[model samples]
Target: MKKKNVISVVVTVVAVIVAVYTLFPFYLVLMNSFKNANDIVASPVSFTGVNVTQWITNLSNVINNSNFNFWYAFGTSLAITVISLILLALFGSMAAWVICRNKTKWSTAIYMTFIASMIIPFQVVMLPLISTFRDVGEFIGVSMLQSIPGIVFAYCGFGGAMTVFILTGFIKNIPYELEEAANIDGCSPEGIFFRVIFPLLKPVITTVTILNGMWIWNDYLLPSLMLGQNGRVKTLPVAVQAFVGSYVKQWDLILSAALLAIVPMIIIFLFAQKQIMHGMVEGAIK
Candidate 1:
């Protein structure tokens, strides 16, 4: 009993240490966002100069700043994230249902292919992806770079693998008799999927959506490459980068902007956190 208590204490200490380490950056940002530039520079970690009025000023400056254009970028990010999540959830569910139901060698190979792609780093293909998008855009007479549709398409493609992977697992545990019953009711394949299988996917779909929305909303590197850093089209993450100039950086406004960018995601995760956990556990077990 004494040894078990000692082990529990050690584990608790380690977990506390890791949690603090992980959240320290957010704490710093939240703390310093309420301070002015001078206060931030002097004592970023200190709470001495923090106040609601200064936080209002900082947030005001960030929101109204022409360079950041918070509202415009907010709209862009919202549109892209929403559109991408919808497409990914819909098509990913469809693909997963098909793969799970077929149970053939081809389906197995295809599922393995998606699983393998998940392990590959995005850095390896980013450059090639950009050029390919450019060429394909020109060939097809539709601009694929620095545009909403283009980014949405890219997000769907990149996000598809993990989405399909998770959804596929959940679909496997769904009884095949359900699909067969729908078919016997004179339902087409499309009808069976939409009317029957799709509705059952709500839990896992929520998981995939929340997961993908977080990534697409916060992604900087891909958006920066696809949409030029200073281009007219930009996501919130790209817009936030405008605060850092070549010679000087505004830590106060930068943190303020960072705070604004993350608040939505924070609220979402907090509200849906239970669903997120439940869906993931269900997917893994099923």
Candidate 2:
């Protein structure tokens, strides 16, 4: 009994230390965002001279600055994320359902191909990706670079592998018996999927949505390359970089912009954390 109590205390102490280590950077950013550049440089670790008015000033300056276009960037990011996630969920679920139900060499091969594709680093394909987008844009007479649709397409492709991977695992655990019974009741494959399987996928779908949503929201490199530095289209991260450059790296404004960029994602995770964890565990176990 004494040994178990000692182990418990040690584990608790380690967990607390790890938690503080993980959150310390975020704490620093929150603390210094409310201070001027000079004050931040003078004492970054201490909030001794921070003021509420400074927080308002810093945030206002970031949001109101024409270069940053905080509201416009926010709208653009929201639209892209929403559109991409919707498409990913629909397509990924459909693909996973088909793959799960079909017991064929082709389906197995295709699933393996997706799994293999996940291992390929983005850097390896990024140049070709850009070139292909450019070429395709010219051939199609619709822009595929520096456009919302183009970015959405890119995200769908990149996010598809993992989405299908997770959903496929979860769907496998769903008994084939339900689908068989639904078919006997005169339901088409589409009906079985939409009315039956898809409804039951809520937990895992929530998991994939949160996972992909966070990635698409905070992604910087893909957006940076797809939407040029000075392009009219900008996500929050890209816009923050542009804003920082215009301000000549003024830390207060930069940190404020960083804080603003993360607020939406933080809110989303806070609300959905339970669902995310549940879905992940269910998918893994089944």
Candidate 3:
């Protein structure tokens, strides 16, 4: 009993430490966002003037400085996220269903191919992909390399593998009995998939959507490479990066932009946190 009590105490201490480590950065950002440039630069360690009025003043300056261009960047990021999620969910779920249902040698081979592709680092393919896109654009007389849809396509290709993998595990657990019943009820395979199987996978779908949505929304590297240095087509992350560069280490504006970038993510997590938790539990159980 004494040993168990000691172990529990140690575990609780470790958990608290880890929680604080994770939260401290966000706390710092929140506090810094409300502070003036000199205050942040001179005494970042000191927690000062994080009151309502300060927050409102800092946030107002950030918004005013944005000149509504923030909304455009946000909208672009959202569109890419939504489009990528839809493509991944639809194509990934279909691919997973085929792999789970059809246990043929070809299907196994195809699944393995996707898994293999997942292991190939984006860095390894980055240059080659760029060259290919450039060549394709030149040939077709349509530039895809620095376009919105181009980035969306890149996301789908890179993201589909893991989404398919997770959805497959969930689908495999979904008892073949359900599919069998649907077949007997005068339902075609496509009908059964669309009507029944897809609906049942809602929790897992929500999980994937949230996970991938966060990633795509916050992604800077891909957009940087594919979208070029054009301010007009920048995503939120790209915009924030450019904002910092333009300000040239001005803490007030930089922290304000950082805060702007963070608020949406915080809101998203807060609202969909329950769904995320439920999906995780359901996925783990099944």
Q: Poorest 10 consecutive residues of model 3 by lDDT?
A: 277-286
Query: What do the candidate models score in CA lDDT, each in turn?
Result: 0.89, 0.91, 0.82
Lowest summed lDDT across 10 adjacent residues in model 2 is found at 277-286
List, residue by residue over 54-78, the lDDT tens digit for candidate 1.
Answer: 9999999989988888999999999
How well does candidate 3 match the true structure, expressed as C-alpha RMSD? 3.3
Regions more than 4 Å wrong, model 2: 1-15, 277-286
Model 2, 167-280: lDDT tens digits are 998899999999999999999999999999999998788888877887798899999999988899999989988887888758898888889988887787688788766765
Candidate order by decreasing lDDT: 2, 1, 3
Give the CA lDDT, 0 to 100, for residue 71 in model 1: 95
The reply for model 1, stretches above 4 Å from the true place, is: 1-22, 103-105, 278-286
Task: Give the best candidate by lDDT.
Answer: 2
Q: Among these predicted structures, which one has the highest TM-score?
A: 2
**Cα misplacement distance, residue 109 of candidate 1 (Å):** 3.6
**TM-score, model 1 to reference:** 0.87
Model 3 lDDT tens row, 101-150: 99999989988888788789888988888888888889989887877888
